[model samples]
Target: MSERINDIMNEEPKRGRSAFQPLIYAILVVLGVYIGSNFSGNSTFTHRPAASENPNKLVNIINKIDEMYVDSVEKKALIEKAINAMLEDLDPHSYYISSEELASVQEPLQGNFEGIGVEFMIQKDTLVVVSPIQGGPSETAGIRAGDRIVEVDGEHIAGIGLTNSKVMEVLKGEKGTKVDLKIQRRGTDDILDFNITRDRIPIYSVVASTMVEPGVGYIKLTRFAKNSYEEFMMGMAKLDEAGAESIIFDLRGNGGGYLHVAIPMVEEFLEDDKLIVYTEGVNSPRSEYRSQRRGRYADKDVVILINSGSASASEIMAGALQDHDRSITVGRRSFGKGLVQDEIPLPDESALRLTVARYYTPTGRSIQRPYGEEIDYDNDYNDRYDSGELYSEEKIELNDSLKFTTPKGRIVYGGGGITPDVFVPIDTIGASWYFSDLSYAGTIRRYGFDYSDSHRDELSSYSDVESFLKGFKVTNVMMEGLFKAGEEDGYERDERAIAESGEVMKIRLKAHMAKNLFGDEAYYRALLEDDNVYDAALEVARNYKDYAIVDGELTLLSATEVEEAMTTN
Candidate 1:
């Protein structure tokens, strides 16, 4: 009976083992099938491996060397070099502003900065103060003309490789900061030290605003800064108060500034809801700016003056007014700069003013001239000159690929600057190499300043411009001194040319002297006594019909009548 029971147990054990083995094998097979399916799925979704390392692997290698190499490398210096290299490939206007150079570069365009305001020039390796800005810290601190800056903040600045930018850096600081400056005056042997508490120096955009003729106002804008619109409005109000019937907005050498300032200035001429300008770009949304109801000179006859340097916002104002037939644009073709640059701030306190959008006129004309692949902006104006477009009447060819018409059906060109209604050729008759050398060598300014100083008492007696003009004389003595100075500087004076240019040179010298002594208004008041362009604009303003014809619109006067009126006027 024991043997039979043991046999049954062994058979039972065998049967249990076989059942468990089969179950385990089935579980293993299922697990293996699941694993295979997951592997196949992952293979289908995964990316392929690269055959070689990335092209920018050198950058990574350099970074590793900078981090863990035995020898130390200046990472900041490398970054500045890289930044300069990057900017070199961009446009000429696109420049890298180092941390130390940012403020001085932006001061003029911003209209104000903290400093002792003085315009200066370098002469004979010495810093010569040209003129102190009116009501500025330098004037307040008793810094006068003919003072030479020898030291700033205890550092010897004279006879060193001190640049204009470096001088600005040393002179300008936050308001309430004191700067110690050592100045050498012309009459004094001992150096004069001035401890000036820097204050906010106002940079003017509107250089002059005066009555050019009876009932005709003139305002010369040097730039469109932050306070430009306000300054312009003030000028207009002053002119209106003086019974000005027409206005001439001069934008001759204005390279332009804030668009916000420009739009409102154009609004002063246009009515409400009139399109001023529009911008478009790939990454930027289309933006359209229209005139609002807050205009001051909406009912006045306006003439805008432009030249080769009048660019960006100036072009916008001129184009908007021309497209709407609100004003007649005079002078030369404007500098084409219809692209919007946005100042993008970086982590290192540096900024990137990248061109983000292209601007268009109300008539849908794009004023952006072609840029080469290498972006040589120096040849831009020269190309215009070479094409004979600046001074010729070769139909003023427009790119048909980008032409548009104004609301009044006037043909407008595109892919270039705002074409003036009346083109004025540059006055180059007296621009001989001798004249250029004298102008460039500071001979004009130096002689003018010296003459003004010697005759200050007598010159100050004439309170009015007309009286002063008649009283002050650029005599033979002054001319002789100027000629001698020019000769000493290796500039040979052309006898006939000098005689021919005498009138213009004398007038400009007197004007510069007046500016240094009195103000910008006085200078312009003296200079405009014989400006041909201003006279032409005044004539246009005197006749509304002539103005309308030039603005590409038919008027009450016929072509014959207009010609007769122009002849008579």
Candidate 2:
């Protein structure tokens, strides 16, 4: 044993290992001490420390807290907070989910949850049902879109400051459980009652899909979930049936989800053997996801719409498409988050979403913005806003040293998020103070709901969206009612601001009414007509070849010296 230790310490360093001599010695010293302490006459070497001698530091601190001169502390809550604080130091994306929060946190990504389904909003301290989820318990139990939930099991709940979670607590339950609701429905003299049985309600990822024009299909994807692929494929099939020759894939405000779902969905839009993304880490090997089969959707012109909120799996799709010149991306730069996490469960039913690997795009773009222990994670968006990057493409700072070129020779900027092929600045037109007040007071939503309820039969009369969009106008009477609602909510009307905002407000009002009658597809159909980003996306979709990236569009950190810097760095 002594001879073996001497041999290891005196071992000559390899040709390229001169720099590691000290580190190698330190490691050997520790190994020598460990082996010397455990080596017995037996062939195998092992050491089992006594339970008392091998105490965990965290448990020791916790035990000390219990015994110290402090009041009774909820150990579980403290531990959870400590775990969160520790993970916060690691990175913004790595997080801790307590047992109580675990299920709710996992619900959306899991694709469904057991509950009485109704999309709702709070207004005047009352819970107003925006829409009963199609085919869900509330919808099946005769709950309509305009109904206001006033009571639960005969107990008054309205006018008592209802919160989203409070409503969820009373409504969501295990399968087969029942909850009674008293609704103040529009056009009804008396309160309507419903006894709804809770069941597994699907949380759809593909929120909206429709033919935006004669040959263009628009699909709004909210997130990449377990069932997202199937939902997306169904949307694709809907577009195919509608004879769609081009697609506008909207991923604005999508925070992202499962990569597994995103990879498969993006693959259907790319040619065979195209690499979508690859993840690598110190422990994790390089894992590449590639398209296996060519689908009909690959031939169609596709435009990806992404805003700052689009991230993770959303970037995977946009990056892949832009890298391969399969599609053109519009909207602002995406929310850069290339870190891949793997949830590790602890004994207390809580879990830690630990960052395990970093994913790169097809052209070796990391897509992750710089992060550090001293950096304030919450100020990221504000910093971008303050820098004027959100409003101007020229304000964006591109690091040329981290740059790579795509297969089609388009300049690909790495390290940050996926920069759009064409930038669409944030729209501020018709954004008057009166509109802001109305939005804050929820006047538009309330008035739209009331109007839709009263005119339900007439609104439903239109069999197609084009007719409804063309015929349904925001009358003076409707505007008057909305103003009245705003005044009642303590937001007095400003004539000048109102004049400036009326057109935009009317468009939003039309969207809200469309949502109440015909769901998300109709809502987007009405809303996108007035959206600046959507307009840009539509043009890109119609003529992707013309709008495609060119060498002149690429920005660099130092244009004159990028070549020298790339080779040196």
Candidate 3:
């Protein structure tokens, strides 16, 4: 048997070994191989063929270690490690997912999860309800926003070092299962107890949508999940009913999901058969995704909002619109994540989410940035800040080699993410260490919940978001209470600092309160009414034709007619 095993393992060492070789050698040393002593005349040495005609050198080494080493080892674990190491040699986006993590990984993108739906946050060592999902099990069971959950299943969960994962473990379970909760309401004397039946709660991709102005609509898509297109269309339908002539499509912080979903959403803005995006790679041939169906929103003026957090499908949609001169993109340059990952399921129920292709815009520009160390790629946003790219358009450089002309003869550059036509610098005014410390300690969120709880009856009186937005104002008493909470949380009470951050804090707190009472729509309506990015986009929409694509950038046309001059020439 040993001799037969030796025959299976005898492969010559290849030139230039990979980075994983040393680790494989270490694993071999740690887990020595053991051969059975019961090798008799009846015992047959089964010689199985390698996975491929050209057997993997790494696999051969691992097999040799398993068969010839002196002690017992988990060959499965070693194989998983080897697979992970091999993928690291490829692009940063290419990664290995374990069987244990596969379900959790798919849950968000699938747009539904089994749980008693109540969005929560750990505030002051307690599980505070940010908001109950409308019509969800929690909300149906009388779980109001700002209610503090003290116990789960009669177990004392709060003030016992509870974490987000621990809370999820206690709350989330099989559908139709019961989970009891003991709540602490601000005004209630006794702890409120309720039993919530777990059910399939929808995870919405479009968090907020409303009419920002009479003729303009504001729709914020949180991600490009499976049902994102449906949610977006529903929102648009409502906007259309409200007489919307223009749309402010907010894609800020929407780290993308399904490409299929995004393509259809992009189609809504484009004409029939227009090339929205195309993908190609060494392995993947050029496949162009075009607008196939006639869209209802074809003639509507569009403005897309993006930031450093917006990526993948977000970039695809934005780039396509910009290249076609269909919309004005506002905000900072987007997060450059143009790689298209294809999830290949392994035999062990795990998955290999490998970067199979690079997506390009209509003008053929790749939005993917150069990848180095994984940490560096993750910290690229901070690097942008350090390099002054986040605050100034001049700091953002375009690669001349990657220049491509749109159909309208406007130049656009590739080599990185989608650069917005109008750049809104990050607001740093009134940002102090005092404000930072308080925010870091979750003081702002906690204060909002506390204030909402106390003012629920008064706040609940407002029937419409517009009425609430115009009528409500943060009082001195509420400000003092927020400041007191900050002080209690070890954040010093600097009256001058608080005054400096007063306006932002007031608006943000009011937004949070609105979110607690109504939903994300009210929250955004309150917050974005004064947001700089939204303001910029609104400005562009107000004077839509005054601005035109010139050279490679967005420029305002002079009062002296250039198009008339060109016609004469």
Provide the TM-score for each candidate, comma-separated.
0.80, 0.84, 0.85
lDDT of 2 by residue, 195-215 (tens): 899999999989888888889
- Which lDDT values do the candidates have, in the order given? 0.72, 0.77, 0.79
Which order, best to worst by TM-score? 3, 2, 1
Please write out the lDDT profile of model 3 over residues 1-569, one tens digit for every residue: 11000000011111234654665545432221211112222222122344653324434555777788677657666655655555666766676678987778777778888999999989768998888997799989989888899988878988888898898899999999998899988778999989999999899988887887788888999887778889999999999999888899999888777788888899998889999989898998998999998778989999999998888888888999989888888999988888887776655577667777888899889988888655566678789999999889999978989988877777778988888888899988767788788777778877887788777888888888888899999988888888899889888789888878888888878887887777888888888755889899888777766676666667867666557645667
Q: Model 1 misses residue 11 by how many Å?
A: 99
Per-residue lDDT, model 2, residue 90, is 76
Model 1 lDDT per residue over 59-155, tens place: 3544564688566757555444444444444533444455665665567667898888888877666787878888898998898876899999899
Candidate 3, residue 444: lDDT:
80
User: Between prediction 1 and prediction 2, which has the larger TM-score?
Assistant: 2
Candidate number that wins on TM-score, 1 or 3 = 3
Location of the lowest summed lDDT over 10 successive residues in candidate 1:
1-10
Worst 10 residues of 2 by lDDT: 2-11
Ranking by lDDT: 3, 2, 1
Off by over 4 Å in 3: 1-21, 24-60, 63-81, 182-193, 373-375, 558-569
Top candidate by TM-score: 3
Please name the candidate that would achieve the greatest lDDT relative to the true structure: 3
